[model samples]
Target: MKSNVYMFLLGTMCLLLLSCGEEKLPKPRAMLRLNYPAPVYEDLDMDCSYTVKKNKMVQIKNAKYTRPCWYNMYYPDLKATVYLSHYEIKNNLDSLLRDAQNLTMEHHIKADGIKNKEHINEEEKVYGTLYIVSGNAASPYQFYVTDSIKHFVSGSVYFDARPNYDSILPAANYLQNDLMHFMETIQWKN
Candidate 1:
């Protein structure tokens, strides 16, 4: 029958095309390769209560002038900013800790989990809690470092891009190293 002849011809053509590797198949999904250089750091001295050594890749921006010792570390290349908020304990140490804890917990709705780590340098009377929030949230990292007496500093790292962990993970991780360096070098003059 003509139908049988047509079916045979179609099958032969399909086999020939496949054998020649002319039929392109969709490729499996793959991630992009984003390579960044290791950071070089320089000491950033401010006239504020505390001093820090920050990453050379980051720049200081006086974004928060309403409060004392408040500024932002702007990473123009990454389109991200690490907002620094400092507080003098006054008579409200408990209140400041509570507020910092609450602010970090606010991201729980979008965060997969929040891991808190405590750091203390007794010789310098520096103590603090580092919050690494895992998820696609407005802030990927939040931390508070205090001397438990006079100085309290908190920071949040936020990207200008949408809340996509995959896209911002590299930048977040890069800024995190800078943040830890900043915290470690913090010298409270109070």
Candidate 2:
């Protein structure tokens, strides 16, 4: 009886020791990681009236409606497109500015907020505002750069996916930086 009890106790202790080899821990939650390549830009080679640098990742194509100097800069990987429309400012600067602002305002209903940054390059005669729209708006970015006399160009970015602010935030931000660089490198044809 004593020997059997000792054996049983030793077995129990062995079992416990074997089972306690390592403490099981719940793993931390997984997070989504997105990585994009650094941008390489080159002068946009087109018959358009104005000149601007564009990321090499984008493909420049005529817009669907195909107006004069209207283009769509498409990022195949990101499934996003930047729509650009150029206009010769023929006494319509006020209306052109109004239209651009109105287009941005249309997103206000769905946008959490809209923040705009003014851009002015006195020597280049480039002046405009970059509108960053937050929320699930269809267009998260919009801008218009104009010499306020002879040239006006406006652009907006739209994704192919359904408007989910969180899912598209990273791509939107990447495009935003590209757009800023594009704007800075713009030079109107005199």
Candidate 3:
């Protein structure tokens, strides 16, 4: 009986010693690494009175006519949507500009920070501001491009799930890149 007790205690001590091989510590915070394929874009032309390049990954859906040129760029794989609305500038530049800025600011309550980047493509006559909302906001990105006279195109990206940046950041980033591409390739049509 003494030998058996001694053997059991010795075995337990050995495990305790070996277990110290790797110092066990709480895991540090980590983020997921998402990699997407090289994106392909196609010319999105229609009766909407404007043209923009859209990611081939996104499926264009004709949203219920808010006006005439409203469209939704849907990412089925990412479960995200980029809401797009185009307006013909008819002396409502101030109103339209104010509305676009207001829409982005609406996410301020839940956003940690908001960054606005000016987008200018003098050749394409597309000028706009890109808003990147950082945090648990519903809309992580928003922008509006215009000729500053006859065309105003705006967009905002939203995910269908709860506003958890960790889970949604990858998807938001993908969509945001697509939005920037769209703005960069925008052209107003008559």
Candidate 4:
């Protein structure tokens, strides 16, 4: 009888511990969205090209710059640069991305009751800090910006925290909608 009582108490404690642990979920680091105008590449007649897709929400452009990697994405709420970088320009891009991340962190804290946290994920081709924001009234969002030896790129998406899957979806969808509109209006100058 004593053993049985002890086992029951232990099981209850384990369950309580599991329930009390902080729930971890994927979140966005920023709330900005991208939009681009339709592409008219053939007219350019250069090695570089641009295209519009996803109902004009994604503007894709390619150029051959010093680093052999040049592309740009402009969303209604956000603008992204993925292009060749001269050795000197690399540091500037890095600084810009870092500044943007810091700005996002400050904004997240001020976003109602949202809590902001950062997750750093790096890869050879792409790397940047992701800001994840969460709150009862707010949807979790991720801000990801990355680049490569010759290119720089960044983006964000509002996503719900795992398991809950309740609040973030709307925000994510909203961001997507805005991005599409943004891409449609983008124009690249000669």
Cα lDDT tens digits for candidate 1, 85-166: 8888899999999999999999999999999878788988888888988888789888999998888999888898898988
Each model's RMSD to truth, in Å? Answer: 3.4, 3.0, 3.6, 16.0
Reference-based TM-score of each model: 0.85, 0.85, 0.85, 0.32
lDDT of 3: 0.87
lDDT for residue 14 in candidate 1, whole number 0-100: 97
TM-score of 2: 0.85
Candidate 2 regions exceeding 4 Å error are 1-29
lDDT for model 1, on a 0 to 1 scale?
Answer: 0.85
| lDDT agreement of model 2 with the native | 0.92
Model 2 C-alpha lDDT per residue in residues 1-190, reported as the tens digit of each score: 9999999999999999899877899999886777899999888957876788888899887899868899999999799999999999899999999999999999999999999988999999999899999999999999999999999999999999999999998898899899889779898888
Which lDDT tens digits does candidate 3 get at residues 59-152? 8898878578888989888888888888888999999999999999999999999999898988877899999999999989999999999989
Cα displacement (Å) at residue 50, model 4: 10
C-alpha local distance difference test of each model: 0.85, 0.92, 0.87, 0.41
Model 4 Cα lDDT, one tens digit per residue, 37-86: 43333221223322223233334455444433244433333332222221
Q: Cα lDDT for residue 19, model 4?
A: 95
Poorest stretch of ten by lDDT in candidate 3: 30-39
| Candidate with better lDDT, 1 vs 2 | 2
Per-residue error for 2 in candidate 3, Å, reads 17
User: Candidate 3, TM-score vs. the true structure?
Assistant: 0.85
